[model samples]
Target chain A: MTADTTRRQLLAGGAALGWFCINGSWLQSTPAQAQADGFAPQHLSVAQCSAMNVIADALVPGAHVAGIAAYIDSQLSAKNDSLLLVKYLGVPTTAQSGFYRPALDSCIRLLAADGMTPQLALTAMGEDAVSDWQGPPASFFSFVLRADALDVVYGTEQGFARLDIPYRAHITPKKPW
Target chain B: MSNALSTDTVIVGAGAAGLLLAARLAESGRRVTVLEAGPKRSTDDLISSQIWARRLKWSGPQVEELGDHKVGHAFNAGFGTGGSALHHYGVWLRLHPGDFRVASDHGVGLDWPIDYQTLQPHYDKIQSEVGLSGDADAEIWRPEGAAYPMPPMPLFAQARILQKGFEKTGRRTAPLPLAINSQPYQGRAACQFDGWCDAGCPIGALANPLVTHLPRAQKAGVQFEHNALVSRVLRDPNKAARIRGVEYFQGGERHTITAKDVIIAAFTVQSARILLSSAADTTPAPGNRFDQLGRYLTSHPAATVFGLFDEPTYPHQGVSGGQLLSHDDYDNKQQGNGFGSSQWLIAHAIKPHDLLGYGTGRPDIVGNQLEPWLQDAAQHLANMTLVVEDIAAPNNRVTLSDATDTHGIALARTEHNLDARTARLWQQRIDEGQEIMRAARAREVWHGPRVAMHIMGGTVMGKDEQQSVTDSFGRVHDTDNLYVSGPSLFPSSGAVNPTFTLSAIASRQAEHLITQQ
Candidate 1:
């Protein structure tokens, strides 16, 4: 085999988990188990993962099934090789987790407060209405979460197919980016 | 001579400009060596994934950015062999005559040391050599030059839909001049239109340095040392006016490579950084005699307007750089609330995710409403980008950061703030862009955030030594052999993609250098 083919194979092998998620096995795990042990997050705590899932689901439903937290965790784990949308916004790869961690913690804390619904929480974030919003602007955090949710939901070949968009490939990616 | 490490010309950065210079100089029998900070890259490395493409972007030392609008260095610059041009959308365009003399005519921004007439021949030569595709006659607002070497790529349905908006608004549009091939040319294949231009076109369709200049340079025996991060330009201790060579890090070891001439074409920020870092205890940096090394830094303020048409627009059918161009407002630099030029690049082939992606644009869209909206918009969405010129201000500059990289070289820091006039122009164009989309029979229309596109003018070229880092030929005013190239030499940020203009400038510099040699 050629070196190019071998390289592609290695890359594809390395990205098998992402491919599995893209192929819809991401929905197999229940939310509780997924947050618990189905896929252990390297960067986020279980509570933080749960919070991310909740917030991401509110931003883009099916995000839990689409494995938004797992996707984000996987990206965060990759560090400089991350595919997270926040990378494009001038956030250094080294500081990406820092950008996410406290924001998710703050979100979790806000959601746990008395009588706070997901929709209301999201609305408050959109309006920047959170009084004690911590770690990056709440509006900015919401925007990032929404973008991340979109990635898991609609940034794949199957995802494109669902949208009726042709997944035309000059060189079809063996795995989702 | 063979045993010695020194070369005739040593270029820091194996980017478009550097590679072009290397190939030309090497072909003329001058030994050329290029030092690239990033890893070696071939076309095989360009995987068709945006996530993988991140590897192509600037992953070197983090640039500390400050200002209302940061230069977006991380997004705009590139790493490895081909540099930022590796992931560039191939929208090759010429600067208008007015673009060359912004200060002389409008009493704003710095004027280029050379006029359009001086660079026209070089543009013509580069266009012929590189092979651009467009209908030059149809480009009503184009400055005079030779016709495009190839016919324009066929417009997709999305472009046709957007063209209606231009017609209705009494504005005109022509096919966008692209460095990508319409048909096979010079053995390179035509573009596949997969809308993955930002991923670094692997098919050799886009005229990146890998496909265009790098190979030629290699064939001409131009030596390239990858992962060689240049720290500073070294000067002869006795002769302060002469540049001796450069100090660089390769394989975790510091090395010095001497040359007769040194060319710093390391994109905008790093180029300026290297010069700023070269400051010694006895003398200032090579081109910082007047503290003008990194002044007048500029990035075009750009925004995208998206519209969901009633008809099946099929937005994914063209290249990422878009299919059509409208320069109707480009010539009129001072218009309405703005003091600079603006143009519309219509019908870009978009993706579902990433920053400019259709999915990312609609943050308000999500939940159950997301799928149907995406599906419909995938087929019917038409989008166009408005590129507004930025005025070159002395306050907008690149400086050396206090923070040092692993190699102990001070990291580059950039500060770029848009002039109120430029911001006003961007807002006005965005408003007009939405109106055009509405006129095109769109049911829904929206615009994206105003962001920096192409970067330019950190080491600006001008006639006056006191006001600029380089002279008309891109030679540092104080240093005899040290020079700068690339978009960083621009005195004014024109409302056009800079690759064509920068390549032409490099070509002009090449001729001047060869003649002088």
Candidate 2:
């Protein structure tokens, strides 16, 4: 077989369970037992990630456990056309980037300015960002962080469960609804 | 490339319709050449997961918009030969008979010149060729069509639970007819019933364009040139009309393909943008004098409702998005409601990776609290999405933006407004759905933040050339030798997915283009 064919086979095998469920090709697992394999990260600093995890769990409970963080991180690492190309270079490509870092720093700066702890200021900024779409809300920092986080935390898999959401998957049987 | 390699037909957008048309044309011994904006992808090059399928994502330069919602432009189009069909869930449903002639019945929304019966034969033919899996006998509510080639997929626990709830609520649900293979026909393998199809099915079981039609087209001596981003249709000064080929950007350089007949199969927004932008380049005065080119853009208002079941729903065990469909109210389009009709696509297989991306009522879950919910919800991931019908409105349109790209091409600007009538319909159906969930004994019920589903209807087809971009058979009304296809031809957005119908219409167009000549 060609290298591409071999690679395709490997991915197909690895994602066999997903393929079966998505395409109706084979029965990968029963509805009950298949929950354990939800994507998760292996190398995350569990302690550092704990705060984000806790917030995510409460927002969409089952999704956090389903490895949404891992998934988010994975998606984040991949480059796309939408990526603010300069962000990865650790340089300011857009004016928003210049404002973003300072806003985060200001959260700490405000605490320092007011004689409050740096950690406490960070927590405060996080809280303010989540509750309202107003204020500087960490200026541009809030937009990037919240947008990226929402892309993961409140996305297709985890978001649905958190809201107890469902889709109308069928149209013919005329079920109870 | 040699100029001598010109063909009788040059098709833009090597997507499902274009590929299928090319294959059929080549089989008839006609020279067919396809130009795709994205990279070429063969069956072997197809990846198994959404994460690995990054190349399929559209890489169009940034666009500017005035609304709270942009088209999510860059991410919408697929950047490969198979186009969006590569990542599509393969949900195939025909437009209801009532969908056409809406202006007569409802006194609003543009009416389609050709009725559902006209498209029915083509739908049946495409379904057979593509091998649709469903029980036509079971779909009594479905429009007239031939039987599905394969049997209905087995119901998983999530669908079963939703069915029970829907049944309890006195709602009607049917098995979702999907392009996904159930038992495998047309020499393709049967589906393994895993839920990772949004990532592009690696196995040939799911009918992605790469696996099904493009290969056949290639085998028929159809030439496919990828990464050829057509900038515009260049025309000559001759008053008669000059079909002088398409100008595109390829490999950091500009290239042109001279052809006799050109078909623009780019998806809705892009297709209209191409014409509008090209008109600006070639014919500055074209104005919306046709009064139709970029008007009446519509998309299904897609919303999701999630219910937590007590039992293990195992949402990840079945087809990506096929099982039960709620059509009890599909044909119930009231004139003033703005909302036409709606359908339910249930038990959508949700992978842990991409599920949370759809911001619904779901709050973010993080840290310690998430694990238990995952453990509990994984077994009971019974989710359903509501696809509401949106009528073509002049206000909801795809317009040209002032923002020019690096190549100096004008970007597409879109403006979408939801009428109060449509909003009321959405609220009513969602409320009803919540009641159904309660009847199903769901522990909780939540709805998705209403967002645009499938983008369509910008460049529409109609009988009157003055009011529509293309004719009934998708032939451009202005240009004699130019044709356009895809969901852009939809005069009115139906309650169901448009892929199946798009394929059917494309088939009809291809046949018309070949035979009429």
Candidate 3:
């Protein structure tokens, strides 16, 4: 696919694919496709992405398959054009990744030290009970991460259909992002 | 740098106010150019999905916000061609008569330089031009004005259910005054009641700038430059009181647009940010003689009341701004343990997700309980919002931040804390809202946390030079041919939405500017 596609062409592809930098090549892919192909993140490290996927998926059951981590990674890398929920929380474009990196690492630390299940760690994080928890308040981070998870899982036409709501489109979004 | 572009008038931001001003000025045989900070977009870009609606919000320089309220600048401000109005819910309401005399009547907040009578004509004009759907006679609290251009939007099941609660509580409800087409008006399609209004009304039913002033501006030959982030108004060094257009950055390159008159209509925060940044070494910013350029910032303290009913309400069947309005306590500012006016916007069409959604508000519900709860709420939920008036406090202001953007221009930092009375009033009204929900016979009723909605003030208009940044006409106090428009000129936030009021002010300003031309 071309690097830039018109709205018609994108919609013609039935749910457009965002241009992502995987490995060294730029390819058109969705977050789900990116996660399945093990697409390398340009901004976040592999370990960080793995850790985030675990917590985010735990927060929303289908988030892992829906590519919550990849969605966040892609949005963070998009800089000023990011569609992350954190933007609505007043997180600056330059400091968006700064919010996610330490928070995800804390989840990694919680799993390593306490050997707690993803569900348990999520409960602890939501309550701000995790010891040595880092990055934006733990509870706040959980809310934001869960919001990100929700977006990927239930913020699209298919997501709306899952709840049996009408996906009435005046102008449908070419890409989920 | 290319040679400076020249125009009779240069308006910053292509939002509602800017487009209205551009169209009015350009049609009167003047060259008007508008500079927008974000990407170019049209009705085709207004996707039905809420996720895509994020693109309509502010994407310019980072505005660091502080204090209890913090203005929620990131969420409230907008980007791109149509600006924030593209994503706004079409809840257009006029300010109450008491709103103009905040200082005289209540001894709190600044008074508007002009009274409702001065703006009454403009309000009537804009309403007639754009067509507002409402029952004028039903809104008994509405001040003397012409009837709405179109009939009110239909009350869906959700709205009818919510109205019963208000009626049971002895509060009267009327169809909401919205700048949306009830039927085809002026060649625009009527609202589809699809609940995608927050995602920009693509069908031209909602009076977004695209279907309103923008088309007029385009037809009148107004030039628009997208991705042009204006830094500050360029004041002529030789004549300190006169402006020489504006300086903006486009595609990493600084450019100048010299205009006969310069209008800063970049919403609330950025409008103040531009003027605050325009301070000269010898002279302070044009209207900052008394350090009042960015003062008196205010936002309505609002919250949503959610309830789950036994009957299917078809929660996703109406506009996002709700279907009905109640101002039963609007005239009595000091009634019911509250100091300011409060109104109810009842029965907003809803979704299962998004920031303002019921599911998102219930962060505690998770695991297997989520999907079932969402499905249940989607079919049976009803919601209404309580909007309380905001008193303009001097301390709550927008100033230049320590931070700078890529072009070395100082970013905006807003500190907005709700007045004690306003906060109390919000709590009182929200509590009342909960009771109304239950009175309507809902099994359970809950309310969301107090939030900042529809930003206003910042560069407020007043008669006194030392007390205000601009005159009643929105011209900066000490500057010639330099003005500020939009919600930034509002001196007080009435317990109603600001779009109708701001658009009226723009019309008034446009007429004044055209007369000067």
lDDT minimum window of 10 residues, candidate 2 chain A: A168-177
How do all the candidates rank in terms of lDDT, highest first? 3, 1, 2
Q: How far in Å is the alpha carbon of A100 misplaced in model 1?
A: 1.1
Candidate 1 lDDT, B1-517, residue by residue in tens: 1222699999999888999999999999999999999999998888766656778888888899899888899899999999999999989999999998998899998999899999999999998887899999999888999999899999889999899999999999999999999989899999878788888888888889899999899999999899989999998988998999998888888888889899999999999999999999979998888989899999989989999988998888889999999999988887876789888999999987777888888888766677678878888999999999999999999998889998999989999998998888888888889999999999999999888898899899988889999998899999998999999999998999999999998998888888878
Q: What are the per-model DockQ values?
A: 0.50, 0.08, 0.61
What are the runs in model 3 whose C-alpha is more than 4 Å off? Answer: A1-16, A19-27
Scanning candidate 2 chain B in windows of ten residues, the lowest lDDT window is B354-363
Count of residue pairs whose backbone atoms collide, per candidate: 0, 96, 0
lDDT of 3 by residue, B1-517 (tens): 7678999999998999999999999999999999999888899988888787887888888988899987888788889877889989989899988989978987888888888999999999999999899999999999999999899999999989988888888989999999999999999999999989988998899999998988889999999899998988888879988999899999888899999999999999999998988887877988999989888998888899999999989899989999999999998877655578888998999877778877788888776677778888888999998988888889999989887988999999989987777777787788888999999888888888888998998899999998998999999989889999999999999889998899999999989998987
In DockQ terms, which candidate is top? 3
- Candidate 2, residues B303-413, lDDT tens digits: the string is 778888888887767877768887888887983544578888988877543322323134344334454555566677677888888767787788778877667888778
- List fnat, each candidate: 0.62, 0.08, 0.64
User: Candidate 2 has what TM-score?
Assistant: 0.80
Of candidate 3 chain B, the 10-residue stretch with the lowest lDDT total is B331-340
Query: Which model is ahead, 1 or 3, in terms of DockQ?
Result: 3
The CAPRI-style docking tier of model 3 reads medium
| TM-score of candidate 1's A chain against the true A chain | 0.79
* Pairwise TM-score winner, candidates 1 and 3: 3
